[model samples]
Target: MPILVEVSKGLLTQEGEREVFPKIAAALLEAHGLTGNSFMTPNVIGHVSVKPESECFVGGKSQSLAVVEVTVPAITFPNGQVAQKFIGEVTDIIDTYKAKPHPRERTYVVVKHAVDGPWGIGGKAYSNADLGAAIQKAAMA
Candidate 1:
């Protein structure tokens, strides 16, 4: 089965869209041993989208955060443990990029998944520690 990975909205700064996305995508491709036109293959598809934040005022004011969505196919292994390992591997990549210092201060990185058929993997909200742990676990797994 194919899997989709999506980045959450408001998770990325403008700089992230232009800089982080490509680097992350490329890292994923390399990790999977995929290159060039291989990104078009059916088993995996990586996508990125962004939504603007909104605000409203009622009795109180509420603000909506912008989000960035990244979707990629999930790679399955023979067992649950292996599957988790695979997820961990991908998660590590996202974490690494999230930890890198950037020019913007209002940026975050998250992972999410699709609920129905053609299910996608979501990168969870990541901090440097979270990313580091995930990377170490995946690498050691």
Candidate 2:
């Protein structure tokens, strides 16, 4: 999984940025029923990018907004409904951390699916089966 969190400067406190990603990562694992799967832990990566409000746009106008984007393999979510639920949950998490409360419309969350073989780590590529086997092995240990 790859998580990208982009926020207007001052939209989130420094402490909030520090707290959000780990919480989001954990929520993702829980959503997938993969909590405590060590193989998955190392694969959950995230980054936070903050830009001045003038540099962030909404409707072609600059605004203070936070955007959370996650990219995972298509198999990660069983269906569109599940993906919607995940998006709602992520929005709530951001709501809790935002410096100023914003409507759901202001906090944008996007989920993108990467076709399996194109997702890579280090210099190697991993298929869904390879990832599943790694997670299972880690869970058993």
Candidate 3:
């Protein structure tokens, strides 16, 4: 799983920016009921990109927006309920730390699932089953 967080520059406090990834990971793992899974630990990987408000845009016009985009293998979410909850939690994380008074609509959360056999890690292509097995193996170690 990879989470990409993009926020308009200065929209979040320095501390908030530093805390975003862990916040997202915690919410995601809890939502998926994998909070304590050894292989699905809180050490989830993510990245944050902050750009000037002038450099970020909505509808072709620059705007103060906070976007959290999560990409995971198709099997990760497993169902609409889990996916929906995850997206909501993601939005909540951004909403909590974003500059005060930012419009609710300006906070966006998206989840994209890579098709089986295309998601890769450690230089190897992994189908959903392969990834599941790998995770299981890691948990047992």
Candidate 4:
């Protein structure tokens, strides 16, 4: 799982910019009720890119923006209600990082699922069944 966060430079406080990555990861784990799952916790990772405001855009116009794109296994977000709730929670997490109040319209959250069989960890690819077994094994450890 990877949750990519891109923010317009200066949109978040210096401290917030430094810490948002792990915070977002923690929020994801919490949402799934697996905050301490050793395997899953280490697997949730991402990159935070802070672009110059001039490079950030909305509707093809340069603007301050905060975008969170979460890419995970297909089994995640099992239903619409679960997906919507997690999206809202992620939006709220990002909102707290803003240096100044930002328009909610500028914050975007997207979740995409891996098509199975191509999601990789280390050098090996994992199908949905493989991932489920790995997680279950980790939980029992």
Q: Which prediction has the highest TM-score against the true structure?
A: 4
What TM-score against the true fold does each predicted structure earn? Answer: 0.33, 0.91, 0.86, 0.93
The residue ranges of model 2 lying beyond 4 angstroms of the native Cα positions read none
Candidate 1 structure quality by residue, lDDT tens digits, 27-51: 4444444434321323234455543
Ten residues in a row with the worst lDDT in model 3?
35-44
Candidate lDDT values, in order? 0.40, 0.84, 0.80, 0.86
Best by lDDT: 4
> Which residue pairs show backbone clashes in model 3?
none
Could you give candidate 3's per-residue lDDT for residues 57-132 as a string of tens digits? 9989997889888877777777789888878777777777766667778888888877777555667777778878
The digit string of per-residue lDDT tens for model 4 on 1-141 reads 888999999889988888888988987887777889877898898899999999988999998899999998888888898777888877787788789878888989889887877768888888889988888888899
Cα lDDT of candidate 4 equals 0.86
Q: By summed lDDT, which 10 consecutive residues of candidate 4 come out lowest?
A: 85-94
List runs of model 4 lying over 4 Å from the truth.
none
| Candidate 4 RMSD to the real structure | 1.2
lDDT per residue for candidate 2 within 1-141, as digits (tens), equals 899988888888778889889988887888888888888877899898889999999899988888989888778888777778788888888888888756678888888877766558777778877877777889889
Candidates ranked by lDDT: 4, 2, 3, 1
